[model samples]
Target: MPFTAGRGDASEEQTDVESFEALEPVSEVSEIFIKMDFRSFRGNVA
Candidate 1:
């Protein structure tokens, strides 16, 4: 699977993983980052 961070941003973080075992940690960490970003954005908007 392939993933990218930050829409329309040139300096974005990205990753690709070929195996399920290798992808597990990446997926977990990605979920955590997404949640954190969402919370921070919500705080900014509120």
Candidate 2:
């Protein structure tokens, strides 16, 4: 979270990777919600 001027490009890339990895679980949760919504939608249609 703390970006220092001394670390420069390498630090920035590392931070980017860290942020991406942190979002991995969020992606999984969104997929689960999408599947649940689809199932409910199908139940309503039927």
Candidate 3:
């Protein structure tokens, strides 16, 4: 149950990916961000 899933659109997810990709140079931070973001995407939002 992703926030994106409920929205039924690719635009929002694309923006999120673009934002995450902007952090690509920061491996450690990006990994952490991706992990936390993954959980958040899976609905562990808080």
Candidate 4:
């Protein structure tokens, strides 16, 4: 049971890495959106 639990932890780590890699692009897109929002806010204020 202990070995099985250890194996499960390893698999969970792998899945976490894969999901993080998949989110990289989405994070970039979010950054772009944040910048655009800030620019629009500035324009409106000015």
lDDT of each: 0.48, 0.55, 0.56, 0.52
Off by over 4 Å in 4: 1-27, 38-46
lDDT of 4 by residue, 1-46 (tens): 3344355446664666655653445346446556455645545552
RMSD of each: 14.1, 8.2, 14.4, 7.7
Instruction: Give the count of colliding residue pairs in each prediction.
Output: 0, 0, 0, 0
Best by lDDT: 3
> What would the TM-scores of all predictions be?
0.22, 0.22, 0.22, 0.22
For 1-46, candidate 3 gives per-residue lDDT tens digits of 6354454555664656666665456456446657556645545545
**Residue pairs in candidate 1 whose N, alpha carbon or C atoms collide under 3 angstroms:** none
For model 1, residues 1-46, the per-residue Cα lDDT tens digits are 9876555633323533343343344346446556455545544552
Q: C-alpha displacement of 21 in model 2, angstroms?
A: 28
Which residues of candidate 1, in runs, are more than 4 Å off? 1-27, 38-46
User: How does candidate 4 fare on TM-score?
Assistant: 0.22
Overall local distance difference test of candidate 4? 0.52
> Model 1's lDDT to the true fold?
0.48
Least well predicted 10-residue stretch by lDDT in candidate 3? 1-10
lDDT of 3 at 19: 63
